[model samples]
Structure formats: C-alpha cells, structure tokens
Target: MIFLKLSYISQSRLTGLFSLVILWTLSTNTWAQKIIRAPYIQLAKSNSVLIRYRTDQATLSEISISTDGKTFNPSIKSTNKVSEHTVAVSSLQANTKYYYRIHINDQVALGDSSYFFKTAPTVGSKDKISIFSVGDMAAGETQRKIYNAYVNRQKSNYTNLFITMGDNIYCGGSDGCWQEDFFNPYHAGPLLRQTALFPSTGNHDYDNQAFPYQQDDSNMAYYQNFTLPSQGELGGIPSNSEAYYSYDYGNVHLVVLDSYAWGKDNFRIFDQENNIQLNWLKEDLKATKQDWKIIYFHFPVYTKGTYDSDVSGEIIKLRDYLTRVFDEYGVDLVMSGHSHVYERSRPLREQYGLSSEFSPEKNWPFNSSGRYDGSDKSCAYVFQNVEPKKKGTTYVVNGCGGQTAAHRFNWPHPVMEYSLDKRGGSMAIDIEDNRLDAKFIDEEGEVLDQFTIFKEVNKITKKTINAYDPIELKASWPGPANSYVWSSGEKSQKINLRPLKTSTYTVTDTQKCLQDSFEITVNPPLGTTKWEELIHQPFESLEIYDLLGRTWKSIQKEGFIDQSVMDGLPTGQYILEYRLKGKSYTLKLIH
Candidate 1:
C-alpha cells in the first residue's frame, strides 16, 4: 500500500509540471501572429503609407490591418509572406493623424488584434524628424548599457529612424553575434517599437554564412532587417539590390552610399563596375533643392585616428575623386566611419597648404598634409577664428561608437578641427530656420563640440570708400603766392606775387586742394608820405618775413627802401602783416 501511494504522488507532480510548461508557452505566443515585430510606417503620397513588419513565426494565412481594432477588415493590396509582409494604407486626408493596427488570421478571422501606426503628411510639409546614427558597434557591457540608457530617454512620438555605420559586430560576423551585439542591447529599451534601424553592410556583418559568400549576396541578414526607400536610381538595379540611395527628410536631402564597394577585392567581386554611382551622384545633387545636403558612408576621407593615409591606398584615391565631386556641388556635410574615433574638420580645401586668405573658390582640391603636428597651437587659434567663413563643410568620423580605443592622434591633423577617442558618444543636429546647429553628445549627455552652419541666402556684401585728408590752407598775401599751411597750423612766408591792383584776391588750387583769400587795397594818397600811406594802407606792411623767417623784408612807403628788392627767397614757413585798426592780420605763402 505504501509503494503504490508513493508512485501516485510522483505521477501527480510530473503531470503538474508538464501542464505549467505548456501554459507558459501558450501565454507568450498568444498574440504573436498578429502582434508583429519592427512595425515601420513610411510616408508615401497623399497621406498614403507603406507598413513593413516581420511576423513572430511563419504563417501562410492572409494578413490584414484594422483601421478600427474591433473590425476584421483585411487590406486587399497587402503583400503577405510567411516571414514578412507589407500593406499600403491609402485614401486618407493630408496632414491628418490616424491610428490603425496590424492583423493576421489563419484558421478564423482574428478580431480585435493590431499594432498602431500613423500615415505621413503630403509633400512639402513641415514635418519634424528625429534620427540616430552609430558606427563600430560591437557586443560589450558598456556599449550595451549606454545604448539602453539612450533609448530609454528618447521620446518615441517623433523619433523616426536610426543609422548603423559599419563594424556593427566584432570577430567578423555570426548570427549569434548579431543577436548579442544588436538585438540584445536594444531589447531592454523601447527602440524596436518606435524607430527602425537602417544598417550598412560592415566587414564583420559580411563575414558570416547568414549572407552568401558571393559579393552580390542577396541573402544577408542585414538586408532582411530594415526596409529602406525603394524608389531611386541605383546602378540600374532594383533599390533593394543596390543599397545606395537618396531620401528626403523634412528640408534635408540625405544620400547614403556604399564606400566598401570601391575596394579592389570588393569591386570586381560585387561587379560594381562602370562608375554608375558617380553619375547618379552628380545627377542627384544637381536636381536636389533642399536646404541642406548631407552624405554618409562607412569610410572617412580624413581622420587623425587609427586609419591614416598611408601614401598609396584605395582611400587616398577615393578621397581625391570624392572631394572633387563634393566641392563641385555645394554638399554641406559628409559623415563617415571605420576609424574608431570621432573628429571634425574646418572648411577644408587642399590640405597641402592653406589658401592665400579665406576662400569661397570651391574648385580647389584638398592636398595631403602628411601627418598631424605635435601641438594644437596653430589649430587652436584657427579654431578660435572659425566663424561661418563662406559655406564650410565638416567631415565627421564617428567610429568611436562601441569599441576599445584604437589609437591616439596628435594635434595638427590636416583639416582636423576636433578629435576625441573616448567611447560611448553620438551627435545631435538641430535644423532651425536657415542655420543648422550640431552638437556632439556623449553617453552622459555632455556636449563634446558644438558648431553652426549657415545657409548662403545671398553672397556676402563687399564695399570700399576713401577717407578725406585733414590738412587746411590758412592765408596768403598779394603778398604771398603759391602759399599753403601744413597740417600743424603753421604759416608760410613771403611769396613773390606780381601785385597788379593791390586789391582783395582769392587763390585756390583744387589739385593741391588748397584755398586762401587776401585783401590788399593800395590807395597811395597824394598828400601823405608813401610810408604813412603804406602803414595806414589796407596792405599794412607792418612786419614782413622771408620764406624761412631768417631774413626780413619790410617796405614803409615813408622810409621806402625802393626795392627791385626781396627778389631772392627760398620757399618755407614764415609770419607777416600787422594790426590794421584793431584786428591782428597774418599771411602765409609758399615761395
């Protein structure tokens, strides 16, 4: 009886445990089919939108979305697959916000099931966008912590997209690594529900069986992860195949390119032949009319980090060609990665040497400056004067995303405006009015660097004017000819003049810009002595002086020194005239 009782108890315990296991699985997978993952809504046209999402598990059943959660209305145009699906919600009003949800049913209509989404406004709308970017993200404790902190603090109402620059995983690539490096760090936060990640194929992400060994691998896990804009010119191939494309976000035009495709090993293998991307670039930039044009790729053209120009390399060649193209068109800013450091540059021209002065001539190519200098003296001063000198372009290397410190760079990296190698950082750019302010922010929310870029409304105004000379001309006598006063207010001496009618006379020289007037009334009375006549004359020759004042020439018609006299005198400063009546009189002249 005891043995039988023990057996019954053991059987009961095992049965109870099995029942709990089944219940747990059912609970987790209850709404898994209809409750999709990574539900993303992209703006299309006329309030119409495209919704892309991945299902929890495979399902061949037709899927649909409910405008109202209570109805089992299925969208007719939706393309459904076992793993992925896309549906278009259309015929809605422009700029109007609507709430809808996703639905998937296999056996019977699954009513009351959905995920919320909103359609985008019509073209030219003043829509606000919030985006995040990262590069060199690998699986690590601190990286994961920072990522979690960032997403937790972010607001989901307007956050639209996230960009992942290369080196997304470490140790080449593996499915397990991706799960740890990306999904794990993001799982704790609300990021997956709000923002969709757009990733470029990094070297590590390509080094796994998840993507085929072929260069034009159609089966990469990165491709399956996000849905990018699907309509643009890209190597004459479908947008999905060519990962390079352009998109409009509010007033900014963004261009994303694949820098790795230009490498020798990758170029021939991927068959990225004929420079199709370059032609597309020129055409795209020419046609774009946005307030700002920003481009991003995985390789930096300039950096003072682990990745330095080694004289002869593919990067140097790429820089030469790329800089010419970017400068030819007014590309406002270019961002890149692969250096495992963060850096910004001045409005750079050929780095070989600086221009004669501030230059707006964009045709000049960037020259090689070899290596960074040891001190930041010159660069620091230049940075101080770094105003909005013309339309400046900054090259940012944002590769210090999630990795160990690669290398330290000394100051004086050509075109380098700022550099930092510490990890756990990102940037925020705010576009307001015609000026764009970008702040480099670290994980702790500290501002590393802040700078502003201005839109060229009209070319800077230029003007020039002449200043007037301050010298004045005092006086001259009939008495003084070719007379002028120095700026010091001094007088000039007896100037030889052919006294015609000893009457008031005015002398002016516009070329020399001098003017003077003299009143000499010679009324020789018949009775009085000539000296008395001269003394009382309006031309009172009381005191006289030679040009240098070293000699004196006086003529009192009374003591009248009958003069063929005073013929020789050098030109200089002197004093003359007398107190006629009550006022003091004076004359100056250049002999």
Candidate 2:
C-alpha cells in the first residue's frame, strides 16, 4: 500500500510540472505578438481623439480611457483583423485629462504611466492656448533634438496644439521612410502619443522625386495615415478634401492650405477666381468672427533660403496671389516651411512686387523694427479688426526644424526682421486675448527670436434702416480721443449718411490709432409697391409663390434680376421669398 501511494504522488507532481510548462509557453507567445509601432494620438477635438497603432500581427484592437487614471472604461473597439488599428473615442469632456491604454486581442499592448491626452478646451473659450510649430522634421538626430527641446521647455499640460509646417519625412515619402523617419521619431517617443500632430504636406511628403501635385497612389500613405478637419465641422468651410482644411481653437481661426500641391497645380486657392477652394475660403473667412486669424502651409511666400522668392517663378506667383487674398481677409500671421531656414518678417502689407521692387511705404506700413513691444507705449503695430482689409500680416518661414541649409542669396529678405540658418529649432506661439506672442527656440532650448502682434479691440454698433431713411452714425470712444476718419474720407466723430442701398463705413481714431467699422443695411418696407424693379445683392436667391402656395416663379441667381415674372403673375396677393446669407425672408407682394 505504501509503494502504490508513492507512485500516485510522483504522477501528480509530473502533471503539475507539465501544466507549468504549458502556461509558460502561452505567456511567451503572447509577448512575442509585440506592437511593432506603438499607439499615437491624432485629431484631438473638444470631445474626441483618434488613436492609431500597428502590431506585428493582425489582431482585434481596443482602447480604454479613464479620467481618474484608474478604472479604465473600454471606450472604443474594432473587431476587424488589421495589423494597423485606428479608433476614435468620442463624447469625452473638454479640457480634461484622459489616461488611455491599448489592448490587442484582449492582451495589454501598452499601458501604465504617462499615457494620457488632454482634450481641447470648449470652442471659443477664453482659456489661454499654447501651440508648437515645426517643419522639415523626421530626419534623424536633428529632428529628435528639436522635438526634445520643445518638450523640455514647454509645460507638459499647458500645450494645447502641435503643428508641423511640412516635410514630415525625409528623402522619399514611402511607407518605409515614414516608418523609420517620421513615425518612429515622433511616435516611438512620447510626444505624439500625448499631443496630436497637425501636419501640412510638403514636396518630399508626396515623393520627393515625383512631387505629385494631385492626391494619388504616390501619396496614399500621407492621405490615409493623417486625418484632418474637412467637413466644416470645426468652424470653417467644408473642404471635402483632407489636402486643405481649417479649424478653430478658442478665438483663433487657423487656415491650412495645400500651398505646395494646389499652388503647383495652378496657383489655385479657395479665393482664386472660379476655384471652389477660393469660394469656400471667402465664405469661411466671412463667417469667422474670431479675433485672430492664422494661416499655415508648406511653401514660403517670401524666403531667402535655397530657393529665392524673387527668382523662383512659382514662389513669386504664389506670393503675389496669396498675399492679396490674405491681406484682403485680414490674416494676422502666416507660417510656412520648405526654406530650411528661419525667417520672420515685419508686419507687411501690399508687398506684391519682386524683392527688388519692394517699397516700405506701400508694404511695410507698420514699424519695420522686427521687435513688437507689447506695452501700449512702445507698441509696434496695431492691426484693425475690420473686415475685408487689415493693416498688415507677419510671415514666418520656420523650416529649420530638422535640417538647415545656408541661404543661397542675401541672408534676409527686404521685409525680414529676423533670419537664422545655423541652427534648427521650432516655434512656440502663446495666444491670449488680443495679443499673440511667438518665440523661435533652437535645439539647445535658446530663444533665438521673439515677437508679438497686438490687435486693438474695436466695437461697432450695426444699424438697419428702411430705404430713403437717412441714418446718422455717431462714433464714440471709451477713452479720450482726438480725431476720427471714416472710410468715406470724412474726418468727423459724427457722420450723417443717406444711403439708397446697403453700405459699410470704417471709422478710425487718428489719435489712439484705434478703428471701428459699422454696416448700414437699407431694406425697403416688407410690402412696397416696387415689384418691377428690385435691387438684389450677389448670390441672393428669390422665389415667388401665389396665395394658394403654388410656385409661380423661382430664380436662383446673383446680382440684379429684372422682375419679369411679375408680368405673368395673376392680379392678386403673392408671397415673395428671398434668401441671403443663410436667412430666408418672406414678403407680401401684389401684382
């Protein structure tokens, strides 16, 4: 009996040992399914964020989010078999920190410490915003240096946005290059996983050799990997194409254009004649009531880098064409890359001619000194808040994020206030209220250049009056004022205007250097006898229906259209519907 019991014990021990080996093998296999490319965050909105990652093997992916850094809730899940996984977690709170983890096939791929992202503040909130801008990154050590420098200097929690000017990859924009040069440098580190990257497309991003203008198979990697605002869901016009888009953060309106692609194709912008982008841009700018407007793209309008703005036909064309649109729409700052140097211009206006023909009186209306002291006593430039016209805009070429190339021509452009090519760096912009402060920091965390743009707050009261009714506009300042100049060329604090039609008047304070604009909309009484002759604004739609609600005539047109349909209308009461600026109005008319 003792021998039998001993044999049973030995068999039991063997069974236990075999079970341990099986468990060990399973754990080793699970670890071997490592994530080739760790998860990164993108398109961080007020209530949503896109998480993307790649694994060595195709697996079901999921993400868990937690606000208290513990007790994570499974927010998003995808069952598709994909090595690359992208999932968007939505309905999150604004301006809140969220800790997240990646799980592939129910196994933890990445988790634990420091994996968190803060959602953007509520739109139009007065919260102070900080942004980092860099370009020509994703090379090697230099790119890492620039990124590290920015991360070291900036507060870990305060940074709200991160933007890349262009050239996100080096040599060729192939999948392999993106893996090694772009993703590994930014995503393999901690920056992109926390703060999303908003990138502009450079020539190198679309295949350096081919430089394909249109989005096709050559640039599929860029188009598929990065997602941007395109549906006008973020306070801009619907671009419908990810190549060019816009978004709003607080009171700042950011316009990102396809300067390299669209400019190279045909200098087509949203404001260009017959271009859809131009039309959308015009409407978008008109709709934006923000206090600050910033535009960024890949190519520099004014640069003295490897390519000369004056000599290069493409550069000159883009500069002249875009400057007009930017100035007309009151763009505050323009940021660009592709120059491989850092150049900041003074507040420039109407500098459409070549560099040799640039005139300070016409172009450099603001102080030519690159430095803008924020104090009221030493303020350099005071841009007006009026629409369709701004005093000036500051252009910055910050392409030295990854690589630096010596300027071929004279170091600085005529309007340049600061220029540097020796070191690579990034730009930090802090926007608060009506003031925008920008700093250029080198790889060593040194402030190489700094400037500020201040916009004086302007308040104008809008007035609506009936046609033939004279309207008097009285301009008053909160503080002591000296004189006022109206856009009608009147130098008076009180201007009496008799307008037969709608008009806009801008009044500028000659003493305080402040300006305000008011619009006078003259509309005739709803039911006037002037049916045969009616003045209509461009893009206005008109429709006429009988009392029975039967459609008699409909005209979807712009400008003046003769009321010829009135002649065919029966001699009875008819309803006239007019649509303009997204508002519809009904009027009772008799024929």
* Predicted structure with the largest lDDT when compared to the true one: 2
Candidate 1: 10-residue stretch with minimal lDDT: 1-10
Model 1 residue 471 distance off true place after TM-score fit, in angstroms: 48
Residue-level lDDT tens digits of model 2 in 1-591 = 000000001111122111121100112132345677776766667776666677776665677877878777754455345665656666677877888888766877798767888877777775678888998885877888888888888856467778888888886877778888888887655677787667788878877445336642324578766657766656677667676778887778888877666532354553245566566666777778787899888889999986789888777777867888788888889999999999998888888878888787778766535344333343445565463233788999999989888897776898887888868999999887666789999999988888766666466778898654447876643222436778877777677865656878888655444567888887854554456545443337788776455678888875454555465776877667777789876666766
Cα lDDT of model 1 by residue, 1-591, tens digit: 000000001111122111121110112232446434445554233344444455565443333434454553444422223444444445555444344444455443232232443333333444544556677776676566556545544544444456666777775565456656676565445444334345565556677644234333545555454445535421112233335667665566777766664321434212432465655666778777776677887777776576774332656666766776776666777877788777777556543222122243452222221112222222111111233333445678877667646554343354666677756666565553344555566666666765554443212222221111112223321112334342223345323332223333444321222344554443331221222223324533445554333336665532322223224544443344455446655444333
For each candidate, what is the lDDT?
0.49, 0.71
What are the RMSD figures for all models against the true structure? 25.7, 18.9
The clash count of every prediction, one per candidate, is 11, 3
Error of 1 at 218 (Å): 0.5
TM-scores for candidates 1 onward, in order: 0.57, 0.69
